[model samples]
Target chain A: MGTIGDLGEFALIATLTRRLPQGPAVLLGPGDDAAVIGAPDGRVVATTDVLVEGRHFRRDWSGPYDIGRKAAAQNLADVVAMGARPTALLVGFAAPPATDVEWAERLYDGLAHECRAAGASVAGGDVVAAPEVTLAVTALGDLGGAPPLTRAGARPGDAVAVRGRLGFAAAGLALLAAGRDGPAELTEAHRRPRPPYAAGAEARAAGATALLDVSDGLVQDLGHIAAASGVRVDVESAAVPVPAVLGPDGLRHALTGGEDHAFAGTFPAGAVLPPSWTRIGTVTEGTGVRVDGREPPPGAWDHFPT
Target chain B: MGTIGDLGEFALIATLTRRLPQGPAVLLGPGDDAAVIGAPDGRVVATTDVLVEGRHFRRDWSGPYDIGRKAAAQNLADVVAMGARPTALLVGFAAPPATDVEWAERLYDGLAHECRAAGASVAGGDVVAAPEVTLAVTALGDLGGAPPLTRAGARPGDAVAVRGRLGFAAAGLALLAAGRDGPAELTEAHRRPRPPYAAGAEARAAGATALLDVSDGLVQDLGHIAAASGVRVDVESAAVPVPAVLGPDGLRHALTGGEDHAFAGTFPAGAVLPPSWTRIGTVTEGTGVRVDGREPPPGAWDHFPT
Candidate 1:
């Protein structure tokens, strides 16, 4: 919607979640005051992310529809990062009262498009008046009888691997920030990240020891694994698979850029890597993340940087 | 915190959820990238709400602490209104980088205070930078072996009752807007609502057929019950146990004021009303709501007013 004030809260929500298909996992959907989601596994993995108007995305760079898709994609990626299949999403939207209802409809369409792509549904949500548009998305996932692959599972001799494109979104963001025109694919990738949803399950099934989503660059996210697992990780720059379009800058961007939402994991020394995964590093007996046998500078995107 | 920008996103979250106790139902709490919550009943009741800075609360009028408590309270109240016990809360906070960390800590303190009061814990949350402060809270509740008392279950011959104070918040809001000094309790009630948490479970235990939380005005909320159940509800103003401090004007406030977060329900005709509940109306074989045998006016608060 152009602005949320005009459409009002209830009407916008009604328009947005109207046509979405409800899965069997969702006993109740958006119409009621709350939603009921089934958790047959007796445990549910949940995470929430809030995307703001100017801070998270700008209207000049991305349309309201793209914003909706990006919000759902990032949150769903979090669940996938945990090696869980995303089941449902609950969204909360806040915007001004002077916004158009049509924009909300388009935004919902984009949200549903991404959710369906990931084999999930928008279970329910709430809408409220606000100064600027803010989207809060909570993603729920099913563990599917598999033990959760936490960051603490990695051990020395584990091979580090990654699935999906790295540095694409960050490079695309740089392109957008510099006001330089780029190919439609590059811009589209930056606006809407298509994370590998199936790779998460594959990694877990392939005996992944530790796992995480690369939303805050490779080296930075690896630091999390290092800290949690208390083991050092060494990255082989030559082995890193950089996207064709990124060329030389690809390595640097992949190492330090953020928001790619790619899956990263560590497997046993002799474990056969999944077809979708590319080996990039290995775990060592120590602490922190090292690039090319040296400690890399701490560089990662921080939303609330001091 | 003064401004969130200065505190940084991670630190802000750490400060906010630090004191939160781990509840019996929570297998994990804040700290991990994602939280795992136990769903012992095999089902989880989920609800979400987003509160914007300028639209939902004015910084000038409310401290960061109050805002945090108010945000958590409203969402948890929804779970209680559904005849469930709140188990966990996941929050998403977006704010400017220039904000103070101490203010963010105080806000978290408020959130933790409310969660403790309601016997729940902050499971996890995400913090991001934004142009203004915004909070998105999602509450997960346990049904406690009782079937949900949905709005569609009310039938003719059901007794209508409420289990908490009404109009205090609305009256407080009106007084605040008018700059008329009133009792500190009235003003505080508007800023921070005290919902009847235990009463919800009790209502379900007492065989409440249809139930709703009085987030909106009593007459207006009753209309929703009427429409959902396809039954008419007649409320006797004289029977409403309004606070004596509200006086005659208080009666009008109780009828039309919103945001009390009280539990209202319909029960079988011979069912004994619980000690916490007071009978105020009865269900009839018709549609819509009537006050004192006359059709109630349509001037109640509408979140998405046309």
Candidate 2:
């Protein structure tokens, strides 16, 4: 396959954008200095995330497609956590010119796949040369007139609930670090997370008082909710749902391993819970996260770990 | 000042977001998962650009403030080229953990300064650790109920016009590449471009048929308009404005140097040109860009330069 340098910049963009499907939200896609996307509700919910090659993902350990999918999944999860439906994604991709063009195509393929899965489209993007591969993803969403479910809305006596799977990615990371063989499914979850795309609206409709995307481990993410809401979040270790695939360390992974992308929220006591969600804890007047009224261990994913 | 690692991700973000002005367009600012910005017109015009450390800008050549200003200026220009007024900006910055927090704070100051000059606000952003410094900027604009002026709208018999200074950045770059000391003014222009942000609406209101931001040299950008509109763009070399600083090579810089970020557009024949715009060329029945009835030199900025 020819390298990106051989194909040139504009030609490479043409190759990457040619086959991607454009959704109704995108009024203008590519071929221009800017893109126009519909914001039917007269407002836009925006979020951005950047994934660097070595710091965020190892090219040797994950395929381009998986990396692309994971990048899109994480950004989309941010919009969903705010109780909005993602409308479009704008990607900024940078890589060495010597890299094969096929790699870029596969990476974009993964991005397209994830966007399609989320009912969103890749509206526009920028491609450039850099010393290391990187992806900067920005997601735009529509609220459909509902107030955004922020992390500060939870109150004392609220019930904390979670929707979707957790812990598989952490366990998969353990296996990868140890060079131990693990189930294909566990490793796959680590490579490409499957966040419940529709669960955010479900939680909002059920009157979620506070919400978060479980990207930095359940306890760590909930700690943000606790700190922001000035409420103590106490979880029952047994109530925390850990995938059976992680074996005995499932609970540990559930508590500290990041990138599960599950929906976690707090609702008014006695409010009906969505079928996808399970009550895991209770909110009380205090500060910070707790496990059975005790302090939890000190392990959560930090971008710049001390 | 402490390094970004010592400050940590959350603290770093807090320091960067603190005191930055949030305009009325931003319903929600940082410290949350995402930001909510008013779209007003039920549609949004969006664009993103990534600036890598070595490829886009050199840390040694430009101060953090200048870098930040340049980044925001280029992105804001993209939105203005589409005849939309920029409303908000979301920035994603990545750098080595050892980077100074003061550096990040200054970069954001530059971003805020430029955004305010363009009548926009900093809505939300992400900061992460990377091996090299990189910036990914996404700009959102509102059409205010006006139909978007696209590059494909130009027709034969249209007059091509350009607003703002041209070739200064290119000449500035030439001075820098040769290690020759040029006038401080010329070098500053290369460091930071001042695009005429308000002129986009003025051109649109004056019946501009096609519009473009001349980011990649006049000939190169106008080529895009010609290709999209299926018409020939013939520039009059004598009519093209060249900055006086480049001495005898002013016309060369005007024709081939990039990053001027001047606004170029096509208007119907006999249409009164906006006072802000100066006539530079004419559109005719044909394809491709020509200067003074001949093909211009084959030099324009490309990310993956061969």
User: Among these predicted structures, which one has the highest lDDT?
Assistant: 2
lDDT string, candidate 2, B1-306, tens digits:
989989888888889999479999999899777999999999999999999997778888788999999999999999999999999999999999889888888899999999999999899999889889999999999999988888999999999999988888888878888896578777788889999998788888789999989888999999999999999999999999875777789998888777879999999899898777899999999999999999988888887765
Q: For model 2, how does the per-residue alpha-carbon lDDT over A97-159 read when each residue is reduced to its tens digit?
A: 888999999999999999999989899999998889999999999999999899999999999
Residue A49 in model 2: lDDT = 94
Model 2 pairs in collision: none
Superposing all C-alpha atoms, what RMSD in Å does each candidate have to the true structure? 1.9, 1.1
By DockQ, who's the top model here?
Answer: 2
For residue B121, give model 1's deviation from the true position in Å.
Answer: 0.5
DockQ of 2: 0.82
TM-score of 1: 0.96
TM-score, first chain, each model: 0.96, 0.98
Candidate 1 segments exceeding 4 Å error: A1-4, B1-3
Worst 10 residues of 1 chain B by lDDT: B1-10
At residue A102, what lDDT does model 1 achieve?
73
